[model samples]
Target: MAVEMEEKPVIKLAAICGSLRKASYNRGLLRAAMKMCRDSVIEGIEMEDIDISELPMMNVDLESNGTFPLVVEEFRHKIRGCDAVFFASPEYNYSLTPLLKNAIDWASRPPNAWADKPAAIVSVEGSGKSGQYHLRQIGVFLDIHFINKPELFLNAFEPPKKFDDNGDLIDEETRKRLQDVLLALRAFTLRLMKGKSY
Candidate 1:
């Protein structure tokens, strides 16, 4: 039996981009995704950007009296509330960015916001895709379930020039691929959420 929209649980996806560059192509991918959701290019999912740029570098000393800093608390809260995660990861020395690692570390503390959550990753990079793999490895300990197929890794400097000067996706083909990643993430998230109250 087909599930009605109202009966099926609404999937919430929260995205965090690795690169903090103002005109980063990775950030552009995430922006395109939010636009697609707003325009109904993808259905049954509500996507939001979770800012990790403001997150401080990990320091055990930052924890005071069993409480985190205000910004860390807010970031952890958002990750905890989302049904799944979308990572716009860009390679840096064949691994995830330090900023992203910091965010994950904060959230993976006592309560572990990422535990048992479904996740998907998209990237725009030079050559090495090892960054994506590095993230998946981290996900193992964090319990972030990632969808295996339909991975997105584009050459941002390729001939077509898929993004504009201000870091917005400008090409239709890349937009479609981004949409595909979102749809797959949504489906995988729903599958994990089935028969359970999240």
Candidate 2:
């Protein structure tokens, strides 16, 4: 006799890369994750790279009558729809990239789009390590619950080149570590959904 198996609910993830460069290592990490999901290597989750390049500099003047610009609204909508977030960013001058902060500000307006969402960060750092930490501080006020284990901070300049000319992550060890972080995020998100944090 055939038996029926219960299916798990799919977790929707919105991925954001701080750098806007086409050949950014941070961006490559996000793409690799999406591929993992497509290949079933990471099951029960769907991730979409949400582009914030179109958002203008955040300003209250832009919000008249409690309405934001079209691009800002769209970005906030994406954040609101996601069950969790996957942030791939590189620290700049002991802080996060301006591109990322601007996007966060826009979504953090009158209605907080990131409130209570589980999120994770995969950063590529070379000595200056304040970027991800700064992001974490921001998350506290935004109410974004970030997982506290298996942080993947890649040193792109280290031996065994992590990426090729295309900026694709080719290092097996890095991929494995990144996978671990993603799995952690998935588990944390599930716990949040079930209202159990253990």
Candidate 3:
């Protein structure tokens, strides 16, 4: 009898935070998500943070001159290399933050690196319902396949129930939900890769 070996498929996921602040609640949510994926037994799924704060605002003239900044190139490269993406956005004035929109615009230029990639968004703020709605509407035009269920909205201002003094996610329920989101993202990415409808 021959021994059989099983191989696990590796899924690469890129994550970005909409807020540039070092102590941003949205960034903390992404950290929690990364931790959940790291501690999971889901096997072969890896997530990395892509810093978008360094990207400059979109300028058509610069692009037309073939002078896309190094940061923009790196951002696009990460998106192109990843199997999926996770966006942790913070709502500002009932819409997505400028940082997140700028990053998205850079990735959607010309070749459109975001097209056909599986993505999920988790909004962390006082009120995220509006931001999530706006992001979804924009996502439709970007052609990114987003997992619609298990939509995560964490109220950072809810106090002692969810975040700590340092703004890290500490609630057990919210942690479980973050894990669920990661698992769902992995499953959906695999389904899309196999040309199956999720």
Best by lDDT: 2
Query: lDDT for every model?
Result: 0.90, 0.92, 0.85
How does model 3 fare in lDDT?
Answer: 0.85
Please, what are the lDDT tens digits per residue for candidate 1 over residues 1-198? 977765667788898999989899999999899888888888778888999999888888999987899999999999999999999979999999998998999999988889999999999998878999999999999899999989899998778889899989999999888888888888888878874655
Cα lDDT tens digits for candidate 3, 96-159: 9998999899899988999988999998887649998898888899998899889999877675
What TM-score goes with each of the models? 0.94, 0.95, 0.91
The residue pairs in collision within model 1 are none
Error of 1 at 43 (Å): 1.0
Cα RMSD (Å) between model 2 and the true structure?
Answer: 2.1
Give model 3's TM-score versus the native structure: 0.91
Question: Whose TM-score is greatest here?
Answer: 2
Instruction: Give the Å error, residue 53, model 3.
Output: 0.5
Model 1 scores what on Cα lDDT?
A: 0.90
**lDDT for 113 (candidate 1):** 89
